[model samples]
Target: MSSSGRPPARTRARVVRRMQRAVPALTKTTMARMQAEMDWFEELDAEQRSFVSMVLQAGYSQFIEWYDDARDRETARATPPLSAAVFGTAPQSLTGSITLQQTVQMIRLSIEVAESELAAVVDPDHAAGVQAEILRYGRELAFATADVYAHAAEMRGAWDARLEALVVDSIMRGEADENIRTRASALGWHGTGDVAVIVGPAPSDGSSPEAVVDQVRHAARAAGLEALGAVQGDRLAVVVGGVSDPDKAGAVLAPHFDHGPVVVGPLVDDLLRAHHSAAEAVAGLHAAAGWPTVADTVTSDDLLAERALDGDPAARRTLAETVCAPLNAAGPDLMLTLTSYLDQGGSIEATARVLFVHPNTVRYRLKRVMDVTGLAPADARQAFTLRVAVVLGRLASNQR
Candidate 1:
C-alpha cells in the first residue's frame, strides 16, 4: 500500500481498469432504460437529446474519477462527487424543457444501471464499496439538482416581480407607450381582450410581495384571465385582461387583498387604454371610504358619485358627459321630467301635475331618459347618480 493509505499502484490500476470496461455497457443500458421509462426524454429533439447525452457521459466519467479515490475513502468523500461543469455545460434553457423531476428520474436510472453492472466490473469486496458510493452520489446529485432549480426559480421570480412592477407603474402613470406595451406582452398580457385595473390596500399578511403576486397570477390564470401585478408602496394594483365586466374580475381577486374596499375600474377595450382603467380605480380607492354601504368589492363606475364628491375630476367629467350631456342633448323635456319625477318621490301622477303634461307623457319622457342615458330614474341608486350628474352638468355649463 502507498504511504497515503491508497492501495498499491498496481492494485488501484486493476480497480479502475474493470470500472472503465464496464462504462460502455453502463451507458447503453442507462440510455435504453431512460427511453423505455421516460416519455419526455425520448421526445426531445436531436439537439436537446445530444445535450442530454453529453451530460450523462460527463456524469459517468466523473463517477469513475471519484471512485478511483475510494481507497482513500476520506479523500474520496472530500472530493466533489459531481462535476460542477457537468451541469453547467447544458444550456440554461434545458431546465425549462426538462423538469426537475425528470432530471431526477434520469439520475436514478443511471445509478440503477451502474449498480447492475458492478459485479461484472469490480470484485465482490470492492463492488460493495462502489455500490455504496453510487447511492451516496445519487443522493448528493439529487440535492444538487434541487439547489440548481431552486436558484433558477428564485432569480426568475425576482425578475418577474420587477417587470410586473414596471408594467403596473407605467399604466398607473398613464404611460401606454410602445415600450410599456412590449413589457406587458412579455408578462403574458393578451392584447386582444378587454382590460381593467383593480386597486386596494396591500395585504398586511406578512407574506413576501413576490409570493402574493404569484398567488394572484395563479388565481387569474385558473380563471382564464391574464394578470400583471405588484404591491406598489401601500397599494396593490393588478391589471387583469380578457374580461369584459370589471366587477367580476374584481371579485375574482378580492379575497387576496386586505380587508378594505377592493375597487375595479371600468373595462377598456384593450391594453393600450388600460391606463384609463387604472386611473379610475385609483381614484375610486381614494373615494371609497365616503360610501360606507359599498360591498367589499366595487366598480369605479359604481363609485362615480363618491369619486365626484371626493373631487375626482375624471369622475365629475364622466358624470357630465355620460349622464347629463345625453339628457340635455336628447331634449329639455327628459331633463325636466327626471327632475320632476325625483322631486315628487318618483310618482308619475305628481310629476305630470308639476309638468302640466299627461301622466303618459311623463312616463314616455322617463323612458326616453333611460334609453338616452342608461340610468333609470325609478331606481333609487341610479336616480342619485342622475341628480348628481344634472347638477354637475349645470355647474359645468354655467362655467362654460
Candidate 2:
C-alpha cells in the first residue's frame, strides 16, 4: 500500500489494463445476456436499443475509469462526481423510455458480465482484487442510477406544475381550448363528469406552491372528487372534476384554505366548459365578504344576488334567464302571483287575496314557480335571488 493507504500504482495499473482489455468481450456478453434474460430490453425501438447498447459500453468504460481512480485517494477527489458521468453516453430523454428499475437491472447484468470475463482474463493472484473492484463499481452505479432518476422526477414535477397552472389559468380566463385539454391529459387529469370550480384564500403559512396544491388535492380526493389546483396571487383556485355536488366538494376542501369563505360554483358538464363555473366561483368569492353568516362552502348560485350587486353581468344574466324569464314565460298570472307572494313577505293568504284566489291556489302557484325556476318563494336566499331577478327583469324589459 502507498503512504496514502491506497493500492500501489503498479497494482492499480495492472487491474486497469486487464479491465481495458475485457471491455469488448464484456460489451458483447452483457448485451446478449440482457436481450435473452430481460423481457423488456427487446421491446425498445431500434434507436432506443442502440442507445441502450451505447449506455452499456459507456457504463463498462466508466466503471474501469472509476475503479482505477478510486484506488488513488487524491485523484478520486474529482468533482462532477463519478455518478453524473455514468450515463453520459445516453441522452436525458432515455430516462423517459426506460424506468430506473430497468436501468438498475441492466447495470447489475453488466457487472455480472464484467465479473465473469475479468476472472478469465486476470491471473489467479489478481482475480480476487478485480472481483472486489467490480462489486464496488456496481454499488457506485446503483447510486448513480438513483441520482439520474431523482433528477428526472424533479424535472417532471416542475413541468407538471407549470402545466397545471396553465390549465387553471385558462379555465379562470374562460379560454379553455384544445391545447388546454391536451395539457390536462398530460397531467393525468381523469375527470370525466360534472365539473365545478372553488375559490378561496391561499394558505397564509407561507407554504410552497406544491404543498398548497397537495393539500387541496388531498382534501378533494377524500371527498371522492378529482381536483386540479393553482395559486394565483393570494388566492387558491381548484377546479374539481367528476363532482355531482359542488357544495360537498367545497366543504371537504374548505379547511385546507385560509380563514375566508370558500365559494363553489355550479357544476358544468365537463372541464371544457368549467370556465363558467370558475367565473361564478370567483364572483361569489368576491361577493362572499358581504355575507357574514354565509356558510364555509357557499354555492355560487346561492350568492347570485350578492354577485349581481357586485356588478357581475354574468350573475345578472343568469338571474334573469334562469329565474325571471322562466317565470315570465310560464304565464303572467304565475309571475304576478310570485311577485305578490315575495312582496308580501311570502304570505300565501296576502298573495291569494291580492290575486283574488283562495290561499290554496296561491300555495299551488308558489309550488309551480318552484318547479319552473328551481327557486322556492319561501326560502330566504332563494326569495332574495328571485326578487333581484324580478327587479332586474323589469329593468331590462323597461330598457327594451
Candidate 3:
C-alpha cells in the first residue's frame, strides 16, 4: 500500500518496468564507458598490475568498511611478484596487464549496476541517493590508485637493492650468467681490460651511496669500460673493467660528485681483484692521508700514511702550505710569468715576450720572488721544488 492508503500494485508494476528498461540502458551505457577501461587494465605489465591491485583493493575495502588487514592476510597466501623483481626479466607482453584508470571504471560500472537494481525497490527519488553513492565510490577508487603508485615506487626500490646484491655476488664469484652479462653490457660493462675501483667519501648532506655507484658505472660505460657499483654505508665503491687508459679514465670519471672525498685504488687485472682492490682502497682512505675525508688521488694519501698514522693532518697541511704559499701569494701575473719563464728554459727575454712586458720587468719580478720565497731562478733544484710545491698547494686549497 502507498502512504496515501491506496493500493500500490499499479505503481509498483510500473516502477518495476521502468527499472527493467533502465537496467539495459544503464548496462549499455556502462559497458561502453567501461570497455576502454578494461582495455587499459590489460595494458599493465605484471609489475604495474601488482602495485595497482594492492592500491585498488585498499580503496575498495575502505569504501565498503571491510577489514583489509584480514583480507590482506588471505590474499597474501598467493604471492604477488614484486614490481622490482621483473625489471631484470624479459619485458612482459601486455598479454595480461591493467591500468589504474580502467580499474576505477570497472568499479564504477559495478556500482551503477548495483544502483540500477536498487532503484526498482524504492521511489524514483530514492534513485538519486544510489547515484550519489556511486559517485562517492568512484572517488575512493581514484585515490586508491594514487596510493598504489606510491607503494609501487617503494617496492621497486627494494627490488633494485636485491637485484644489485645478486649481480655483485655473481660477478664476485666469477659465475655471472649470460643474462647478468647482458644486463651489465647494457649498462656499459664489457668485462675486458684492467679495472680500477673508486671509493668516495660521505657527503656532508648524506649523499646517496647507490647514486654515486651508478654514476661511476655510467662514467666507466661512457668511456667504453665495464663497471659495477656498490654502497657501503656512506661510501660508494665502483669496480671498473675494460678501460684502456687509467689517466683518461680518471678524467672521464671526474665529473661525478661525491660527499666527503673520492679515492681511486690501483688498477687490477680482473673483476675479483678489482673488487678486492676497490674495497681495500676505500678502507685505505681511512688509514691513508685524510682518513674520514680525502680526494681523487689515493697515492697522495698513501704517501702521507705514516705521518697520518701518527695523527698529523696538520703536518701534511703545513708541508703543502709551505711549498705552495709563495706561488699563491705571488698572484696570477707572477705565476704566469714564472710558468712562461720555465717554459722558455728560464730565458728572461722569452718570458718578457710571452707576458708582453719589458725584459727588465720580468727580471724585477724574478728578483722580488727570490727575495720573498728564497727561490733562485738559476737553481734547478729550487725550481723543481717550487713546481711541486705549487701543485700541492693548489690541491690542498681545493680540499677546503
lDDT of each: 0.83, 0.85, 0.54
lDDT per residue, candidate 1, 1-400, as tens digits? 5675445768768988888877777777788788888888878998888778777776776677766766656643555635364577687777878898899888888888887786557766667667777887777778778887887778776777898898889899998888888888777776768888999988898988888888899998998889998898788899998986777788899988999999999889878798999999999999988887878999998889889988999999999889988888887888888988988999999999999999999989999999988888989888988888888887888998
Runs of candidate 1 with Cα error greater than 4 angstroms are 1-10, 13-54, 69-77, 81-85, 108-132, 177-193, 218-224, 309-313, 340-354, 358-360
Model 2 weakest 10-residue run by lDDT: 71-80
Q: Compose the digit string of candidate 3's lDDT tens values, residues 245-359.
A: 6556655665564534455666677655555455445445555553444345543224243333344553345445553466567677666777678779889998899899999
Candidate order (lDDT): 2, 1, 3
How many Å off is the CA of 356 in candidate 3?
45
Alpha-carbon deviation at 296 in model 1, angstroms: 1.9
Model 2, 116-185: lDDT tens digits are: 8876787776677678878987887788889988998999999889989999999999999888789888
Q: What TM-score against the true fold does each predicted structure earn?
A: 0.77, 0.91, 0.42
Worst lDDT run of 10 residues, candidate 1, spans 74-83
2 versus 3: better lDDT goes to: 2
